[model samples]
Target chain A: MAKHEHKLEIFRGYLKFKSNVQKIWGVLIFLSIVTAIEVALGILKPPILMNYFLGLKLINWIFIILTIVKAYYITWDFMHVRDEKPFLKNTIILPLLILIPFLLFILLWEGSYIFDVMLDGLKEWDFDIY
Target chain B: MQASTLTKTKQKTWGGGGVKPLDAAYGKLMMWFFIVSDALTFSGFLVAYGFSRFKNIDSWPIADEVFHHFPFLHGVDAPMYYVALMTFILIFSSVTMVLAVDAGHNNDKNRVAFYMLLTIIGGAVFVGSQAWEWKNFIKGEYGAVEIQNGEILQFYDIKKDKRIPIDDFAVLQSQERVTHDDNVGIWYQSEAKLPEITLSEVMEGFKTNSAITVRVEELNDKGQKIILSREDAENKLSSATRVVKGANLIRNEYGNPLFADFFFFITGFHGFHVFSGVVINIIIFINVLLGTYERRGHYDMVEKVGLYWHFVDLVWVFVFTFFYLV
Candidate 1:
């Protein structure tokens, strides 16, 4: 009985150590490789892919997504949120989720308005701007 | 009964030290909250920029042509390469930061310190590169013709249908300069100088010289610049070029003023953030080397600072996209 207890304790200790190492290395490797891939894509900026998107360039989307991925990993893993409870994570992320879209929408709406003004009116102005 | 009551009272006392809300180490949670606020600030700036961009859709200068400088090779229309390099530097710095965090986890103090140093250096280099970019932007390109009202009028000869330089025409300075300064008079309003050559110079030149062409901002049915043949440009230039120069609101030799405004404000703001980030990173770097966090048996200090550094990188990603890519 004593011997069995000792073996179980040893196994648990080893597993705990291994898990810690894996968690640390897993995030590090993932971030490094992803960053490398982004750099490569940016350098290449292949026009074939760029043209496929409807007036939206591939380079822009790639940078945005890659940036999001990096932010997600840094916040979740390196920042040790993986160990955090769900409620805690929600507290941190919830406000951002609500605000980001609202802000973007306002910008887009207002931006479109400004574009219309410049295009529709300014171009037709007869005043001589020598 | 009294003894049991005393023990219950002791147990009932609030155990305030037990697991705090959010279950995060204090430093990490605070860092996260800080990032949230910082993100909001950047979003505001970007949204405002977007609003401006949308407002001037037709005349909004194309981004590609404006940032066409390639280092060591002048006039080699290389766009997006330097910004691409800056992006790589930031991302690499982010990698080093993660490595430092990893080293901290393994209790590899030396490795953590080394990686942190590299990150700090990377940030410094990125800021320096940004400064260089600003220098190029501030120093105007192919100086344009200035008017009395500080308005700029760019010359596009109708005969040749190309943008001409102020030097192309024989310019004469105004003799009756508007001098109101205390030195010139008791009430000094500095005289505004108008371009002597004006648009008519090109027009008149083209009327005599048949090779000039004029290209206006208005696009044709094919979406190309509406070009006026020598005869049409000569006719129009003679009539319209007579108007006194207002402000160069349209495209000019130094590129576009709108571009200058955006370039100065957006990149300048971003550079300010970077400069401040570098300063803060240096403070933390010194702290790390001094064994401030090491003495605590927890490198949480480094991790907190890492979050700020990464946040800087994150903002740059957006700036790079809007400033260069978009």
Candidate 2:
């Protein structure tokens, strides 16, 4: 068995907790607030955020970014990934960083291409066998 | 990694190894990798959803429309509220789980057990909420008509500016309608159970109705489903095949079958994770009550499951964003 000490600061050290239990409560409130914002945006669906950016809605981008931010807190704080050694941190995250973005790019690009092909309404939308 | 810590083993063969290479116990490290792999699998499902949705962008069902029914608020237009509540419940469970880990770190037996109990209750509640969501999805509220080309055409009231269920217009009678079972189909190709209202009934009902209009799955420039004129609705209804009541693997009252498929698969998979997390927590809770970790001088098991519980929460955030909010 080894002794473990948790770094009791979050928000890039802007917020600090004297105890682990307090930090856990703080995170729960923060996460609830973020989710509330997301739900509110979803319900209201402001016209300004409906504008498109890079073929996606600006509001959608905000939602995805907020989701990522929530994921970060859940992983780094709740899962204690922040306290892990640099080797462990890089190994865990670097693979996901490479793989997730690559897959998203390839699949979304191909999906859009398929959409274009289907839009043309040509019966034969298949690519060449080569 | 420091040079001083990198001591070369005197053995002839190099076995690149650290007892806790991932900066935790081997068990926790293995759990981390398991989570990473599971995350990839979930991402694959979601990306596949994105692919199908993009390909059918003009006709993909609006998630808010499909998932509006909250637990007791029947027929109420409460979109994203229930799922939001489920999200908060799951996140609060994750908080309790981490608190359990922190309590275990202090070797506080009573607190660890208490938090673990709360965490388990929270997880069970979240799973229950998801089951309710699936029930609502499977038993769709606003029934639609499926035409010759497999596109769903929903009915709307111009005055109300909202969708109307098939039962509102289509007359229900004691007709001898048989289920489309294996015996009834050509070449024994079984189909879903027969819907309540037939195509003729729907068409006739539409003719009698004055305010009802047909909403095509195709989206207009404003990203709203196109509501066809009465004459055009009749024109499209000429090719109507059957009345779709609810969602199954084959049929969906929602716009696209693919949308239903992804909804079931992604959320179903996440719900399974929450279920297993609760089971695992229960097992650990029992062990904590027995003072297993206290006897062993540490509480790494609590910490490992905390990681898993949090991962479940993390996945839900993404699922909520992509499935509902997006």
Candidate 3:
């Protein structure tokens, strides 16, 4: 009888941990707080809020970091990545890790070229009064 | 042959449990993998958008002026408020979806149904709001002059300190010189009505009115016209009346052409996702109601759809930031 009761307790706990409304509520509240902070920072544009400890513009860096955090949580909790195995997780993230950086690099390179072109054309880009 | 391939991929366990190391139940694993790939796609688009924005760093249109609309408040320059509200709505719906998933785990059918209904409503409302936003943008508020060079030049009333009508600048209306192939010689076409107040008329007005300032695209930032110093405005007005061919790529009367392009592509893309998401959600909602999961003894399907719904919300968060706020 005692063994049976212990087994029942473990099962109940497993069910609760696997899908608990309260835990989901906690995640929701935390996400809301983070979103509010982002909104406040975006609107206030606080001076001296550096993203890097040394030289980087803190606002842009912070935004990127916060976005990554949100992405991580959405994957882990909402998409249940924690329940997934190491091999499966690696399979999914490996491609993204390579592709996203490559895409950003290309965009930056092309964008700089366009910027130079626009700057050079400034002499003729000006308006004509007729 | 397919059976052999499946068995070959399914590795035998040391203890004879027969479960693979990388094995996860289909829905949960697929959802995670799909989200990962979708995230990469969104990041690519946004990074490209950022690249374009950086290229035009000096003269990018201000987010405040472009998306300056609020519900039930006309002509009130409220920026980011509506989009902010939409963000909150999406997040709230996400909360409800997660809760529904939780309820499903506990086998609480009633709670799951209620939350699912709420999520559907939130999605529908978001789609409606987006339609309204598109309508306001497509039917522009202030009318502008369509120059011969395919460029739009906005108007300003010198005396009223407001946008003037193209009809107000009319020295002579355009007479129809050619007819279309469809209506050739069938009916006499009338001339296009010209602005009532000509450039010379505007120049005369600017000279007399001390407060009047004429802003030109080439002269203004982002190629948008604004009232400037009275003397400078009058000087611009005194130039020759013959309008030149203005380029539409740089700047135009409807804010900026680039802004229009981004607005259509990004929002249209996001809206397409929302539409498809809703359709998918409806399908799954029906499945849930029919007790398919109840008989299956697992509510994993609900969890999968919840992931998709949350993803739709996630993309909106970035859209709200870049499109409306930044």
Candidate 4:
């Protein structure tokens, strides 16, 4: 059987745990705080954040950033990726880093082009296809 | 199986292929790979949703208005509250699952069993709540009229700033309603269930109600739905064809049928994931009770399933952000 090791610390050693039980609580609290902030922001939706930034709402960017933060904590702490070997981490994450952006770019561009076609081209040509 | 013979074979097979490259057990590595692929699949669905949303930006339904129902609070406007509660439930389950894995690492069978049971209960609750939400969404609160151009026209009380349900204003008529069934219709050409109110009844009611106005799905520059004047409202209502009650694949009381389509598909797919996760947790819970992991001297199986549970929770974080928050 392979040897087992548990990562006993999180938050860059700001909060260290002597046991896995304590570590679990620490990560849980961190995740809860993040989620609370997200819900509050969603409810408030302040006017400043409602302004557009980079073609999207500023509030949307905040949500996306906070979501990524939550994902990181869940993966690293809850899923025990912190204890995994470097090779294992790279093997799993590298492919996603490459493929996700490519897929997003292609799909979003194609969708907008379709939108344009539906808006302008359809009006001009008037195909009977519903 | 001598060591010397094994070493000789390993040396010959492409620079010692017999060893595990990343020092991870076969199962854990495979679970990680599966998670990555599954993440991509979910991303595809969400991006497609984003595309359709972008396409119909002006006419997209406001999610807050669509999902305003709470469990006990009928007629109260509680936007995103239930969904937030559901998110918390799922996240709490993920916590319990990680605690179970932690207990497993320590070889504490009782704690593992307890936490695993809690995780299962949490998952079940989330699934049930999702079903309730789907029910409310499908049986829409206020019905809308489908214009000839496939646009939806909802009613609003100008003074109250509230939507008026069709039942409240629509006068019931004695006209005999016929539902197209397979027995009466042509073979294999059955029609969907008819809406509760007819278009003429709705138009007549609107004519009598002086305070009611029509709200279209299109958003104005202020980011609010465009409410037509009494004269324009009458003009728009003249083009009404079908009376839509709730949401389905073809039409919805909410604007843009595609919004409801993506809502059903994405959330339904996620609900299916949560359902399967609960079943898998139950199986693992049974094994824990049987002392299977104790016999093995390690609880790696529990840890692998924990990874999946955490992934489900992670995906919900994104889904909640996109579907409700943003």
Best candidate, DockQ: 2
**How far in Å is the alpha carbon of B192 misplaced in model 3?**
12
Candidate 3 residue lDDT tens string, B1-326: 10111123564223213333366544455577787778787877778787887676555555655566888999877666777677777777887887777677777787888888888888888888898887776655544433444444455666686765444443443444343443445565545333333454444444554544444434343224455566655444444343312213343345446766777778888888888877877886887798766655556678778888888888887777667655
DockQ for model 1 equals 0.30
Task: For residues A88-119, write the lDDT of model 2, one tens digit per residue.
Answer: 88888988889988998888888888988888
Instruction: Report chain B TM per candidate.
Output: 0.72, 0.90, 0.73, 0.92
Where is model 4 chain A poorest over a 10-residue stretch in terms of lDDT? A121-130
True contacts kept of each: 0.53, 0.87, 0.45, 0.69
RMSD of 1: 9.2
The CAPRI class of candidate 3 is acceptable
Best first by lDDT, ranked = 2, 4, 3, 1
Clash pairs detected, candidate 2: none
Model 1 chain A weakest lDDT span, ten residues long: A1-10
Q: For candidate 4, lDDT tens digit of each residue in A1-130?
A: 4545787877678878887778878877888888888878877778898889987889889988988888888888888888888988887778878887888788778877877777788674665553
Error of 1 at B33 (Å): 1.5
Every candidate's lDDT: 0.61, 0.85, 0.63, 0.85
Query: Number of clashes in every candidate structure?
Result: 21, 0, 11, 0
TM-score to true structure, per model: 0.70, 0.91, 0.72, 0.91
In order, what DockQ does each candidate have?
0.30, 0.59, 0.30, 0.57
- Candidate 4: segments with Cα more than 4 A from true spot: A1-3, A116-130, B1-19, B182-190
User: B206, model 1: CA deviation in Å?
Assistant: 7.9
Model 2's alpha-carbon lDDT is 0.85
